[model samples]
Target: MANIIITGTSRGIGFELVKLFAKEGHQVLALSRNVQPVQRLDLSNVHCFSFDLGNPNDFKKVEAFLEQWNVVDVLINNAGSLLNKPFAETTIEEFERVYKVNVFGVAEMIRTVRHKMGKEGHVVTVSSMGGVQGSMKFPGLSAYSSSKGAVITLTELLAEEYKETGPSFNVLALGAVQTEMLEEAFPGYQALVTALEMATYIKDFALTGHKLYNGKLLQVSNSTP
Candidate 1:
């Protein structure tokens, strides 16, 4: 079993990922703003840490916990923020909030745990199809989509920086999935995929797919544009 760290584990896709990884007997460190839900899961293989990804100061707690671990096999940056509003009405604060959680937070987490990663370590950050140019662009998602685009760029840069170091970096530009975030962003609309299904694919990818590609941005979807 490998040691894995997942962010935003309290609910949605992150919550499902915790269940799948714990069921597989991997040592999972789950981080979220409120970890009570994960604690209630009652999985011995999973440990919950309460921290807000939008706040960089809170990352110290994650760093402290990872300091005790000798090796971390995978780091899944799943925590994110979404702001669905017309560009005309979007405020600077909203844009910063989205970037703080989706971009800066992910970068800080990787920097904190990178030293704990072993030779085969993998870092997988969740992106979105909305971030892909010429894919499917949606209005009222400029801030959120832009933040995800930054994540994909950052992943590529890290992969190149660490090419000789052994750890692999990749991003998954996911399509619409049935999660609370999706419902909030696009109310009354049903998605083609479920959180559990997405989590399963992500778990498999982190464990096995990393070996196949590095510095790659994968588009996970069932339909074509």
Candidate 2:
């Protein structure tokens, strides 16, 4: 089984992924700002790590933790941030906040674990359908969407960097999923897919020996199942 590191595991998709991975007997390191709530899980294979992903300095803490464990076989960049304000209305601070967590945060996590993940591993970044075509009009998504775009781009560059190696990097551009992020951003709007179902699909997809997905985007919609 793979040793996996998942960011933003306190709740939502990250939390669900931790459950699924641990259930499959894989060693899971769940990272979040506060992993206390998730620590109650009875899964022996799952370990909770608390830290702020948005801070680059916080990665040193993660690095120290890695010294105690084996090389991680997979790294899931599942944590994200959103600021629901129109481009004109969005403040620089808001934009920076979103990018800190959604873009640079993922980058730092990958940077910290890249050496540990050598050849036989995979890196999956949770992007969004908003990043796919940019034609769709979603008010206040400019900051968040652009950050996801950055993630997609990072995936392509990293995949090429590791081309000779067996490790793969891909982005799962999910459509709307019912998660706390959705509810907090779009209060009354219903999601097209449930987070639990989304997690299940991700787990199954990751397990599949599909090398074609490297440096590519996989859209998750009603037809995904």
Candidate 3:
């Protein structure tokens, strides 16, 4: 039904999202550093490609893909890097690496595809509960949480800057979901929400959320991991 681009589609919520959209007959571009998982699916109306959010060259792949279809109806910035180490032990390079994927990467993707998105397009960025101000904070997530926070601010600014032109922006500050990323961040912690559940919510929102929301930060958390 729409031309949608989703990152971090190798696993978790992103992977589920690809399936849902393609099953609904939408044109889907599924991007991930590891594309094998998506390739294995071989779903109809879906294309998989290897992409690195931290690599500038990889963005050209997105542009190349867009040559087939100029417009992007929806973009879900779902890729993220997490560092669970203590703040004191976290090096500057390590911190930058997280932001490279979580912060700067989101910015680059929006800038690269903004032209393709008209007033009706929507950009949904997946953030974490730790990124929300006054939300429950976690230990050993300085880099990861801070980077997510920055993306939220960036989304707000982008929405304000381009409100008149269209392509609204929104950020979803999610709580713990039972996904590999969550396990890597907090071992043995089981979240109430499943990856599929979150993915379903996100897909539904990305398709229609822009109609009512722009430059808004939504806290989508029910439990902690």
Tell me, by TM-score, which candidate is best: 3
Q: Estimate TM-scores for all models.
A: 0.97, 0.93, 0.98
lDDT of candidate 3 over 157-194, digit per residue (tens): 99999999979999999999999999998889889999
Q: Which of the numbered candidates is closest to the native, going by highest lDDT?
A: 3
Preferred candidate (lDDT higher): 1 or 3: 3
Q: Per-residue CA lDDT of candidate 1, range 200-219, in tens?
A: 99999999877898999999
lDDT of 2 by residue, 71-129 (tens): 77888889888788879988889999999999889988888898887667889889987
140: Cα error in model 2, Å? 0.9
Query: Which regions in candidate 1 have their CA more than 4 angstroms from the true location?
Result: none
Candidate 2 off by > 4 Å: 223-225
Among all windows of ten consecutive residues in candidate 1, which has the lowest summed lDDT? 216-225
TM-score quality measure for candidate 1: 0.97
In candidate 1, how many Å is residue 48 off? 0.8
CA RMSD per model (angstroms): 1.2, 2.1, 0.7
Name the lDDT value of residue 183 in candidate 3: 94
| Each prediction's whole-model lDDT (CA) | 0.91, 0.83, 0.94
